[model samples]
Target: MTELVDIHSRTPKRRANEAMMAKIGKLIWALLLLSGFTRAATAGVLTGELDNPSGTLDDQFVYTLSIQGSFDGSPEFPKVDGLDVAVGGKSQNVSIINGKYSHEVQIQFILSPQKAGNFAIPPIKLTVDGKAMETLPLELLVSASGSPRLPPSASGRSGAGAGAGAGAGAQAQGDTPGLFIERKFSKNTAYVGEAIGVNVKVFSRIKVVGAQKDFRYPSVFQVKDKDNQKSNVEVVNGQEYNVTELESVIIANREGEFTIDPAILIARVAVQRRSRSRSFFDDLLGPTDLQEKRLRSESQTLKVLPLPTAGRRKDYSGLVGAFKLSGDLNPRESKVGDTLNLSLILEGQGSSSGMADPTLPFDTKLAKVYKDKADYHEELDAARGIDSTKTFRYAIVPERSGPLNLGQVTIQVFNPLIATYEDLKFDMGTVQIEASGAVTSAPLSSASTPTAGDTAPAADTALPKPEQKAVEVMAKDLVEPHSQSQLRGSDIITSSDWTNGGLALSLSLIGLVSTGVLAYRRKPETENARMQRANKAFKHSKKHLDFAQQCLRKQDLPQALKAAQTCFKDYTGAKFGVTSASVTLRDMESYLRSRSVSRETLHELREVWSALDQMIYAPPLGQNPTRGEELLTKSRRVLEQMERQCGRS
Candidate 1:
């Protein structure tokens, strides 16, 4: 029989691994020697244990009795208080090594608790080689049919969290079928370009055979590099559940309050197969049937705040997280004109996706540096959310031989955790360079070159070299001596200036009057008109709808769905007088709810919105016109509904 499983959780693929069975064979042989087994001819030893110490009222546990070496008649089984025990299965194995035979037998018994209470099973007495032997006693606790209960250690309550099955699941998702989903976010609020750590989980009480799951985030949130899911048994409140969880990082591409849809799971649950009468074979095999269940979590809102403008650094490249910067410069010592490799590794705990390259200060006279594109990759770790590295490589060709410097390479990052900015600097150690390998250049004298009114001196004249000298002034500033006489009469205004100034002022006033009239005439006459009466209402939405239909006809499902969603969003935004293009259906709901919009209108709006949204991300089922046509007709109808509700009393 298949055990309970979550399709959303990570399931280790079981392989035909005889290697593990070989190791178990070795272990069994070691146990034989430890128990003083002479050979298969010797009487076998007996050992017994319960598969699980406790189980729910609706659950069934197992106990196994094993004998090593060899055995006589079947060992007697024991009766437990307040529990029904039945033979679940039986098996045996024999091996002959170097003509010495060894054999083992195992008996499995199914223990079903009759009622919810504590029960103690007394040790079972058995005869091995005609000697009396008794196994140790055991205890089990079965809680009443409600939630599961366990001791503190098994619950792992300390680190897991306050609530078992808490978070996004239990809020609005704890419905029938004993299944729930949870989403743990590092922070509900984050800045733009900031990476938010998210863990999506599903908790279920019922065992499932197979399941498929998908999570749809708002268009504004970009989910990236999801971690491998892990499955575990978690006890929440008193109920036990098989919980599957995974880690992911989301970056808000735009700043807004967007509603995130719940995580969805489609699983095939295992239920007991019914028959008129039960058979013994059904007891061990546990025949069951698979029933599909669709589970969705509660919706949430992620508030993406804009990046802070205060105390921002000039070198900041919109990187929001803790980061470290280090550089590697190859060949510390080289000659001028030699190309050198410089690798700068910028690693951090947050996402560096779409991060621009750092600006390196290159001295044109010293070396011409060419920047190679950055290489980036992320490491996968469950404990530490996200770790990524962005490396910038550069090729430097020296123009002169001297002490070389690449200047200060600093990358500024905003640590959202600490709400602080860090300037990461790369240390470019002093690089010594040898003289140029090839170079030849000489200056031309004034006599040899065509001089510009400058004569060259004779070789024997031996003229003294000119020296630049600095002179100190008596005061910081001194007026020219004859300045009073030079400024006396030439600065007077004439009659021509007065004439030109008056004419210019008249023309400027005339132009101002004409401009004001034009502006007044161009102003919208019906500025306060309803959205339905606006110019871009039905006709504008029609264009988008037409494009969507064309896309659907061409069998471009994704593009068709996208175009349809756009048509709805644009028409709704325009009808509600929403100017921002980023507002989604949920956003519109809140916006309209505040203005006393009717529930019917809101419902209609949501119906169209959700259908388009689900279809856009949904995997292709086939090329079908029903879905596309229905969406187009529904979108058009919603626009009309808004029109009717616009001004009618």
Candidate 2:
């Protein structure tokens, strides 16, 4: 009975062990399968698509192809045969999709076809997982430009419409599918020479492929052949197929309606769109379908009306844009030969570049006017417009006292408001001339001296030379006179008066001779050597300044500094009695001190020289000429002051 009980327990234990082993085996198999799947997912992959290309052989166009995929190994773009390709980026991106690890590599290329015909883009090969993968072939069409084509779908406003819809696909190829073109004017009413904004937009839906792309642009009246200014690129909705500005300065050649010629740019471009479903396979192999656009903006025309000839063209001096002209007289009442300040001010909407010097008609009979001065303030704008003011101040001299009439100022300019050009003229605002006011009363008068006829003179003649005997007798008669009586050897001393008088006279004569010699030495001709030295200093300083000006104009900072250094050296040699080779800041200061130069003046000199040195040896001060010019001006002022103080006159 005990043996039978042991057997039953062992059998149940054996069954439980078998069940556990089966469960463990299944779990191991599942883990192994999951690991193998993960490795496959990490393997390299590549996918791409090429948009269609269509345009004439003579016309240039851009054909674009893009690729997106994953790679465990490095990826490279395979060159497509028979196509002129320019590759851009072969970069990579990483992300996770639906909790699945993912990696992507992208490559882009531009192509321009040489021949016009049906063309096929060969498969692009890339290496991944040490294996090569390729993109499928793409179909392209190149059609002759200006051919009759189907009309584009009537959709959005301006064909680019409100939002991206079917229009995005249709317009992406080209806005205007047909060869029709039209011109539009922003406004119908405009004056002669008035700038009329016009737009010539072309629409087409043709596939374009090549190196050069197509463009459409706005139109302008009295302008032609602006096709070269067009630009083409993609936009948010689809593509902006347009060109830049076709600018024209309206100079009214005639008085009637004038038409502006149509501007056109024909090109080919690739068109593309997103795929319906982004499956893993599609992501690696790209979407099946690729779309493209090839189109041209049609030529446009614009009408510009001429200025009105009926209205009183009176004071119109061809002044355009809105402006306010006013004149003011300074000291309204002034005498003849006295200065009368007449100022004319014109301020309004215009480019600072366009502001011309105004002409004021002053009565030459009443006053002689000189072009005194003119001041201008202007703000230039690349967009919008410009605002500026021109002020002219005239120095008028009255010839005679009377009522003077300053003639009316007239200016004619295009009126954008009225759409018709108008002339503005104003007559001379009258000014009353008065007698001169005496600033000082004439009180004392100095009488003039009479001429030769009025004045008498006494006759004069030279005295004859005294005889030798007379001189000897007189000397003896004055015998006891000082030096005469002085004993020499056996001669006895007598009058001291003769000796003193003779000695005094001899001293006076010697002093006069010395004075004459001193006067001769002080002549201005003697200062020629010093003048030459001073002039040399000026020329040297000037040379550097001139060189600095030239370099500054050319925007060469390094060269400007070198020139400035030369200037400083020359200035030092000529002005301070110091050569450039031996001169230092300390030496300059010491030299200035010896001359008793003002501290402020000395500081200026030191500061300028130091700045020049720093400019030459250190990094540039923003712009070359500007910084150098400021330094040059300061140096000039300082050196001039120093020279004056040093008695350089």
Candidate 3:
């Protein structure tokens, strides 16, 4: 039994030794594989080729260079020493597959030989993992477009041509089609305010994954699509591309061909397609076939024809583009002192779309102009093309009239579309007017007499009472149903006997209840109280204002505006009873009016708030600071006026 136990222990020890040996063998194998990969990295191999002449001057050929090596250490592309590259010259990236690593690069050149001759592309060297690899030199034969020594065409075939036919079939499967580009103009004829649409497009049959970097469009040509209009991206017919269009105004500036150049897109794409592997293990251990192809798009050309001058006008003013003119009269017919509403709309495509404000000519002998309002709207394409409209409104009162003529409101613009000078002459047609006789009143001799049809001039002694009556009437006429309820209640309370003993009792009770509130709201008795309130208000306002400023800087006008409004409301709610969201200009006006604030002060305050709201929500002018300063001045003046008037309330 003892001998059996000894045998069992000996057997276990032998098995353990065998297992340890197997593990050590695996470690050795792993180390050897790693060393092989490391050695392979040090071998840098570079490859390059020259364009095979296609015999056509316009035909573009692509040249690709690839370098494969292991950067056992840090590696970068070898810098070219003495070569002036053409348009799209160099692109490079490091790639690794299986145990092999490579750095790939490409370039483009527009080649036009001075004369038919032999040419050679110089050899290039690649550095990988500290070792240099030299690429073979490329030689090319330059030939005329119509040459005779070319290879035989497939027209001559026979029973023994099977091998050649198969080779041709294989080549066809790997062949790539070339690229084409074109530029187009919408029209050569246009009137003033017409949009001259221009488009640039690129077409290619080569499979392109993406651009190495963003492609920059040409700069010499200006795009009328301001604000990034006239630009679009679309996938059409299984192809992806970006297009830019410009709508230039047809201004008859020079009445000649005004050529706008096309924006070009040059891209570098991988020529070889990635092949499929047999299995997961093959994918991890096999070498990938490396091949390359080159392609380029044809250069684009655009023709801008000048607008016709056959029926042109001398006062054309060179405004060429498409547009619509709209106008309206407030009171087509009115009595003297009655205001006439005049609105005109000029919207269209052109250089002056957003830059020009239309002016209306009026006859001062027949009418007196009071006030005018104008606004502009513009739309842009790509980042440069612009389409715009402008509207003007005016209040004109007939001073003395029989038949008043608005003459002609002439709008001048350069039409880039028609390539001619043009003008828009809008006639106010003709307005018929009759005199409104003066309003006369009969003499009255009563001490105190009031009538429903009374038209007497307000006397000095009764001015206050009559003004009060007018205010009451205006309030009743303008207020809504809900507000009317509140007004009625106020009226009832004011007419009650609260001015007598009841008022005294009520005042005593109110004073007792407000004593604590007034004290709490007063200048702090404790240092911490004042500091805490000021600090809280400051922090809240500053945080909101900072966010508002950021949004404004980003042109997120809506959010910036909301933040500004919130800041004011927050500050007021914390310091006073007014919440910004709940308060409005009208509310302030009513409060000031009740407190007997001066009309000038109230008007200024309303104007300040209204201007701020307009600037925040509406289209902005070029200088925001100017508008801001105006707002600040008005705000300060209104606040000072409010403080002076606060004591009175």
Candidate 4:
């Protein structure tokens, strides 16, 4: 009995101990679950890498920072002592895998070594869900001379950075021996509107994959056709190099001292990467990398003097070249009130594209005159530079029946070489006219007069009489009236008469209402058509402006300037219902004046056009990246002003 009691007591104690142990185990399991949840919430990775771990001091490399998993904000880069960093590009990716979301953000920076030494790129910091994360530090060794040591490729990396690196990478490579650019100018001093030649040469000792160039000059100067000459091998500075020459013609529009910016050439050179393997197969399969090298030419200053004002002619046409003038009157005989055609041709060389139509001096005693717009044609001549011809046509109506003189035509042009003004004259002689014997109601034929270079026969002075054609008449049978009372006197009243009168009145009222509705509908349709035309004009102008901006970004001064000018010209043409090619600077000025455009605005427009023209005619000294931006802004403003004026009209 005593042993049984003791066993029962131990059993109760054992049960109690078992229950306590179970509770403790449950608590431990809960804690482990909570820890796992915390880790899942804070899970993230940050890493950094360099494209090239070791390179020359003049070399440039790409530094990349990548973050994987959920992040709160962007990564913050700590400034390094010996590295110059520029943001190259950025990309992001988000995906769901196995029911879990993953996010990645990668940023690329262009790293240029400032000096030759070992440098540590500091760790970058970021916050992921309020928890701090740090990236691994990168080591870079820059020497004075040698090929760069490339690092192992990173996982999940894209090759877009390589494409962006093509242009800027040239600067990442240090000063390469036997590679440079030289700039030469025909003359340092010139008169305004004088043509100048600029030559740019590139020398390279290494194999080049591709090249990009940025050439810029002052706004006061104009750059013309840029010719890229065939490259040839040459020896310079005791080294053989592939030499390329680019030639451009430039003209200064303003008289002042201006500095031509330095031209920059970026070349992508094929470089062989060092391989660690000594095996023959490995050597044969070694990788090749493209390294960028930049060469810049020295900046130059030019002095431009204004044209001389002494002995300037009153009829001077602002021409600065050699030219000749000729005039002729078609049909030496005509009757009074008949139309006579007058033709004048101006042909020559030297800044011919900039000349305006020559003024014709006709005597008032000759006839009543109506002048047409002059037609201009230009061609590039290797011997004389730019050859041009302008033809002006006029229609004159004789008022008297006697012999009359057509008067003299005078044109004055400035000879830049001799610093003198030369006057060209054309005498039209005389013509005979007879009084009209009979008045005719027939309209004149709508045929055009013979153009200067046309081979067709001259149009007849009188309209051809129309031939009369006879037609056979057809007979029709007469129908009898349904009601005899309708043909009788109106004194008799009938129910049919009242019905017909009421129906006729109703039909007349309906016709009047329909006419009013049609008129109302046509008005809005006309307005809508006008609005659509206006919108189209605005869109076209914007497209040209956008193209100009793109050219500016590429550092293409000539194309950018041309696009800007074309934008304005297109807008003017659309608003005025004229072809853009037919509109000259003078015509634009006249149109703006008619629109009551402010004098200040006009002056601004002139300045912009002058600058653009200069760029088109002459090569500037240096590259100015910001010049395109400024021109773009100005052009946008000018276009806006023009839009407003057109809207008001």
- Give TM per candidate: 0.44, 0.42, 0.42, 0.48
Top candidate (lDDT): 4
lDDT of 3 by residue, 486-547 (tens): 66543655535656768889889999889978878674665455445534654565567578
| Candidate number with greatest TM-score | 4
After superposition, the stretches of candidate 2 with alpha carbons farther than 4 Å from their true spots are 1-27, 42-45, 52-83, 130-132, 146-356, 363-400, 409-424, 436-649
Estimate, for each residue in 22-112, the C-alpha lDDT of model 2 and write its tens digit: 9999999989877866775566555565432455432333333333434444434445444566554353445455544555555555455
Stretches off by above 4 angstroms in model 3 are: 1-44, 49-65, 70-118, 125-133, 139-179, 187-195, 204-223, 226-252, 255-263, 268-318, 321-326, 346-362, 370-390, 401-438, 441-649
What C-alpha lDDT, on a 0 to 100 scale, does residue 84 get in candidate 3? 28
Please count the clashing residue pairs in each candidate, in the order shown. Answer: 7, 41, 48, 22
Q: Would you list the clashing residue pairs of candidate 1?
A: 4-207, 5-208, 44-70, 147-238, 148-238, 148-239, 169-181
lDDT of 1 by residue, 116-209 (tens): 8888877777766566676678787776533423212223433354443222222313222455566666666777877776676666777766
CA RMSD of each candidate after superposition: 27.1, 21.1, 18.8, 16.6
Could you tell me which 10 consecutive residues in candidate 3 have the lowest summed lDDT? 165-174
TM-score of 1: 0.44
Whole-model lDDT per candidate: 0.67, 0.53, 0.49, 0.68
Between candidates 2 and 4, name the one with more favorable lDDT.
4
